[model samples]
Target chain A: MRDAYHDELRALTGRLVEMTRLVRSAMSRATTALLDSDLPLAESVISRDKDVNQLCEEIETSIFGLMATQQPVAVDLRTVITALRMAADLERMGDLAVHVAKIARMRHPDSAVPAEIRDSILEMGQIAERLVTKTGSCILTQNAELAQELEQDDDHMDRLHRRLFRMLLSESWEHGIEPAIDITLIGRYYERYADHAVRVAQDVVYMVTGSRVGE
Target chain B: MRDAYHDELRALTGRLVEMTRLVRSAMSRATTALLDSDLPLAESVISRDKDVNQLCEEIETSIFGLMATQQPVAVDLRTVITALRMAADLERMGDLAVHVAKIARMRHPDSAVPAEIRDSILEMGQIAERLVTKTGSCILTQNAELAQELEQDDDHMDRLHRRLFRMLLSESWEHGIEPAIDITLIGRYYERYADHAVRVAQDVVYMVTGSRVGE
Candidate 1:
């Protein structure tokens, strides 16, 4: 019985890593769709969010089952509870990606990225993907050091986020209000995606070390 | 020992309700700050958020202690877990309010809401406070019926959110890009605040009925 319980806990970790992979893909494709104005790609990102939601639900169910039967104690209990928090963060990351995709759909056939701001948005997207990838690795490897790396990536994301605003507010901005609004929201989506990814990494650190990062 | 466990559970509910009250006050003052350009009020809202965070930490510590000592099963297990989820949602709502407060601080001495869109923003703030008030009641009473009301309030918030964008994009919008950007982010903060409140209510419903609403 104890062996099965540990196996179930391992399976829970596997599912969380899977969630990170899906969210990463969603963010990657959503970025492409935004930059290229590919309607189909945007639609795919939006539709596949359900898969992330389902995985989160599965994780919750398994954690509840584990708690009810095994009554996980000490580090094991911390692991399951931390898994629940990580899954929630990962699910929100998926939603943030969809929010980005929806911007692509809203402005279909017209790329949301203005020429001057394109590089910033592209960098933000790249940072988002990098953060989530690291988040996945952190969850799978339980590497507290790798988790520490996510904070630096999140700082880079924040710098890119501020740069995007600078571009928007610069005197050279010719994109007008509509695109500015889109970019403001799109920048927000990427920043929030990075934040959630960082949160998942934090949860991993907490699970492994039983201590929170930066807290 | 069982009686002590149940008392802790009741205390958990009290803490959640206290969180809701803190979040509600935060939003209320945040809205006034945004509308009145009240820097002190905004600063107050921002500083008070740590209080909310501290309460959440206390709740988590108490829940962990309860789970370890009692090994609560079945409905009690669900109750403790749901309380954790509700605390998280409430904490996020506090952050969202702080986001709104920050916008007010950013534009201090100049109101963030333009005169034309002021009413809609005010209404959004009112709805946010209402939703959280009901959320507090739902947690205290475990009233599934009252929990259902939060969905309708959230729908109203969504409608107001849409209305905000329409005003910003309208031909008569004379505020230009800077204020438009501020309003865009302000609108998003309130919308997300409402979404979190609704989630708390949903968790309350699930805690009471052992089922989810709108799922």
Candidate 2:
């Protein structure tokens, strides 16, 4: 019975990894669709969001069922709960990507934000994606060091986020309000995406250490 | 033994409620400090944060003890885990309030952020405080309806957050980067405080219904 319970927990993670993979793909596509100004790619990114959202719901259902039947504890319980929260982060990250895609569609072969801004944003996406994968591996391997390292990476993303905002606000002051709003939201999306990645690492740290990080 | 485990579970919740109260008070002080641009109040908020952080760690230790000694399961496990996560939320909410207070200290006497912005932020603090209290009340009583109501209130805070950001960003675009940075951080503090309030309500809902909200 213990083995079966462990098996159920492992299977829960399998689905989460699959969900994580899909969401990261969506994030990359969303960024590409926006930065490259590809309307078809934007359309696909938006359409694909529904799938990630559905997977999130499905995972929630699965976790609740596993909790009901197996009733996990210690590492097992932490794993299930952390996976559930991470799934939400992935879904939101996916939505941010879709949001970026929408911006691409709005421009339709022209960049809504300037090329320099787009480069920073693409850089932001890459940072967040790397953190997501890092935490994913850390949790899978139960490696606390890898998870803790993500905090530094998250700090880097935050610096980039602030810089992007500072640059945009300055540029918009020279330009106008319309561009300012677009730029601000883009800055926000990247900042939040990075935040979710930080959250994933935090969960992993808590799971392994039995102590919440930064507390 | 099962009854004893349940009691320990309930005791863990009682401790959580205490920490919740402390964190909420810190939030209230932090908000006042922000609006009044009170340096002493801001410093006090920072000093008081240690109390909340300590309580969070203490609660975590207690729960770990319970899990280790009692080996709780099913609902008992859920209760402890929820308590742990909620502690983190409460702690983070304290940080948000401190973030607001730090901004106040940055400017001194009066903020670069406009009075209108300050008033809007005060309004945000009030709504968020109510939500936090209601979440605590709901958890104490296992009231899922109140949890739902708290979430609905979050939607209002969300709208206000968006409205504040749009106004502040537009206003600050005419000025310079620093003011916009201030407004943006303020906007973020409100948004995240509201998010923590929602998270508390989520824990309440999960505790009562054994079902995830919005999932």
Candidate 3:
């Protein structure tokens, strides 16, 4: 029975890793769709978001069942709770990717990013992808050190976000209001995507170290 | 023993109400700070956010204890889980209020919203306060109907958001990039504040109806 309980806990971690992978794929594809203005790819990402949502619900239900049956305590209890939180973060990241895909779909043949800030947005997307990939690795390997690295990775995205804002706010900005709004929202979407990755990594740190990150 | 479990459940509900009150106060004071450029008031809101964060942690810890000791299931289990989610939403709302207050502090002695969009922001603030109040009342009373009303209330804020964006993007916009960025972020903060309210309300709906909302 004890081994079975541990097995269930391991299964929970496996589900989280699976969620991380799906979310990573969603963001990578969504970024591509945004940059290439590929409507088909955008639609695919948007639709797959439902799959992520479904997976989250499944994980949440499994968590409740595990907690009730195994009655895990101490580190084991924390692990279950952290898995719940990580699943939520991953689900939200998937939703953010869907938002990115929708932007791509909305603009259709034209990229959501204006030409001036296109390179910056591309860089932001790359940072977001890198952040989530690291998040996946941290979860799979239980490498608290790699989880800590995600914080520094997020800083790079923050800098990119500020630079994007600077370009938009510059007096030389010639894009019309529509493009400005698009850029602002899209930039925000990517920034938030990175933030969720950091949150997942932080939760992993708490799970492994038994102390909240930065506190 | 069963009665004691129920009592503990009631206590959990009370903590949620307390969180609601704290988040409501934070939003109202932060809005005032923003509109008045009151540096002291902004600082207060920022500092008090930690109080909200602490409360959420306490509540979460208490919840884990209850679940582990009581082994609740069915409706009781769902209630605890939903409270957990609500506490998170409330904590996030408090953080959003801090974001608003920070913007105000950063541009102290000058309002974040330009004159043209100030009224709209003020209106958004009021709407946010109203939504949260209703959310609190719904939780206290278990009024699922009132909880459902928050969705429509959030729609009002959405329309206000769109209108504010229109003002910033207008050809006649003369507020320049700095003010435009400020207005954009402030507007988003209010919008997101309302979104959290809706999420809390939706959680309430699920608790009462045994159905996820808008299915």
lDDT of 1 by residue, A95-178 (tens): 999999999999998988898888888899899999999999998898999988999999999998998888888899987899
The A-chain TM-scores of all the candidates are 0.98, 0.90, 0.96
Candidate 1 is graded, for docking, as high
In model 3, the Cα lDDT at residue A116 comes to 80
Higher-ranked by lDDT: 1 or 2: 1
lDDT of 3 by residue, B170-205 (tens): 888986777777777888889989999888888888
Name every residue pair that clashes in candidate 3: none
Stretches > 4 Å off in candidate 1: none
All candidates: TM-score: 0.99, 0.82, 0.94
Candidate 1 is scored at a TM of 0.99
- Model 3 lDDT per residue over A80-109, tens place: 888888898899999899988998998888
Q: Evaluated with TM-score, which candidate comes out highest?
A: 1
> What range of 10 consecutive residues in model 3 chain A has the weakest lDDT sum?
A175-184
What candidate 1 keeps of the native contacts, as a fraction, is: 0.71
| Model 3, position B181: C-alpha lDDT score | 75
Between candidates 1 and 2, the TM-score winner: 1
Model 3 error, position B61 (Å)? 1.6
Q: State which candidate, 2 or 3, has the greater TM-score.
A: 3
In terms of DockQ, which candidate is strongest?
A: 1
